[model samples]
Target: MARTLKTQVCIIGSGPSGLLLSQLLANAGIDTVVIDRKDRAHIEGRIRAGVLEQGTVTALEEAGAADRLHREGLPHDGFELAFDGDRHRIDLKALTGKTVTVYGQTEMTKDLFDKRHADGQIFFFDASDVSPRDLTTAKPRVAFTHGGESIIVECDYIAGCDGFHGVSRRAIPADVLRTFERVYPFGWLGILVERPPVSHELIYANHARGFALASMRSATRSRYYVQCDLKDDIADWSDDRFWEELATRLGADAAANLQTGPSFEKSIAPLRSFVAEPMRYGALFLAGDAAHIVPPTGAKGLNLAAADIRILSRALIAHYADGNDHHIDTYSETVLRRVWKVERFSWQLSTLMHQFPENSPFEKRMQRAEFDYLSGSETASRALAENYVGLPLD
Candidate 1:
């Protein structure tokens, strides 16, 4: 027998976006039920980008989910850009009066899971065949199977926060949906080790070989990446090989301090910029990666998801509290304005930091010139700083 339930909102996906949105709505006294196809352990184990903008921190705080984040997250004031065998710093706090927090996405997800788990409404590690129905109507319902039993959740609104591969975006009719995308020729091969980061702040390096980044999850856990052919397999990259390539890219001074250790995790992620138009289709609203994706170069993926949740949560709250749908009507437009800016920033940073196989000598010189201009020009540095910390949420 199919079990039936009712809530003010039905949220698909249990990622940080879905959990954060649910927590925010719950804070506003709105009822929500969350569903995901993966189990809790599997969800929390996925390593991802660690940089968080101030707006994202505020959102987590508002949802009462920032306790662990603040206690464990590292506050970074600036980061280094290495090129031409030299290092230049972008002082984020000095330029924008703001700093980003470096807390692993895995840890952040853990925090959300711990907080929401006590509420007893999240269905995880169990959901399958989840689908949204009657999204064109004022009331929408989500149906899925769990524990070999069918479940139907009817709600006034549905949130699609499942991510780029999720079912929510696919729920939108083919005629009504439009997509824009750019898939990069290379991918980032990343590793996680117990060693401390070489530098307290992140280092984004451009070298004759490719681009590399030195980031951290905590005081003792380091995350590093180097650009590689998109077709490159993880098996070809041993722990020693990755460390050697990273050292060469970071230049001498930074490389001299590099630590070596066995990697606990390693993976390759293809870079891409993707966006789906009109994030809302009647009562079904898309948020996070379900709506757009930016290359990780600018560290905008998670922050963009947070931005989407912030906008959609506010709109939903207004609809329920004052019966106003103004924000709801303009949800897609409002989010996309900020989304495109972040996309441009990500695209620019990826272009500046990576070596393309198709690059001619002229193109390479142009890249070098752009790097030199950015390194020497305070105005250019400030612009990068502003976008990196993030633009305004509203």
Candidate 2:
């Protein structure tokens, strides 16, 4: 017989979104069980985006998961936009009175896992054949195999924080699901090195060759990326070649200061914008990469996930506290409003900073014109700054 357990909420996937939602709900006296297909080591080993919006920081603080983040995360007031061999700075803090924290997603996930583990929150890693049933009914249950034994979790609600490729989103009926997507022509070839970053603040460069970004995980660890053909082989990009290309794209001053090192981690990530409408289908609500994906140019992927957690956590708390369903009823609509805004911003940034192969002379001139305008106009810079630091969560 399958062992049975009960919880107020069943969280699927152990990524940052799933862990964060579990943390918030657990803090509110709601019981949660998290299940993921990967082991803890593999889950925390994945390197991801590091920029965190202030709102995300707030959410982490509320969940009691920000203590380490606060201690180690770097705060940035502005970032540089480089084009035509010149750099234009967007003062995020001055423009929006908010700053972003540069803390790797891996670190944040580790923090969440530690907090959850300490609280004795149940987790089933290496879970197999996980399925959500009766989502339309009040008593939804998730069944999966763990430790060579079948187990079932009965819950009042289910939170599908599993990613885009996960099973949660697929569980929603195709007829009810609507998706919007735009896949870019190129991908980002990123490298993580044991060296200091060229710039103190992040730099997004639009070069004649392509787009390049200078980012860091800490004072001693640097992460850099250069745009490349989607089909480009990772083996073709050795340490010297990547650093040489990166320095060329960043121009003279930054290039002169650039430090080269062997990459400990190197991977190429495709760029795309995707969103599934009505993030909720009955009791199975989607969150994070399971529902949407934004190009990394705007650094909105993880921030968007944190936003979804805030909305879902509040809605679940209301449902459990006083049996109020208003928040739950309107969760999808509320979250999507912010999601779309973020999508637009990501699209705009990607277009602005990346080179397109199909661009005509006229198109090239238009791109330059926009860059010049942004460089000259404080208002335009401020607008970008506001979006970069993240717009207020509604």
RMSD per candidate (Å) reads 1.0, 0.9
In order, what lDDT does every prediction score?
0.92, 0.93
lDDT of 1 by residue, 1-394 (tens): 7899999999998999999999999889999999999888888988887999999999999988899989999999999998857888999999999999999899889888888877665564569999999998876899999989899999999999999999999999999999999999999999999998999999999999999999999999999999999889899999989999999999999989999999999999999999999899988999999999999997999999999999999999999999999999999899999999999999999999999999999999998998899889999999999999999976
lDDT of 1: 0.92
lDDT of 2 at 180: 97
Worst 10 residues of 2 by lDDT: 385-394
Model 2, span 1-394: residue lDDT tens = 9999998899999999999999999888999999999999999999998999999999999999999998999999999999968989888878888999999999999999999999998999999999999989878999999999999999988899889889998888899989999999999999999999999999999999999999999999999999999999999999999999999999999999899989999999999999998799888989999999999997999999999999999999999899999989999999999999999999998998999998888888888888999999989999898899887768
lDDT of 2 at 99: 94
> How accurate locally is residue 394 in candidate 2, as Cα lDDT from 0 to 100?
82
TM-score of each prediction: 0.98, 0.99
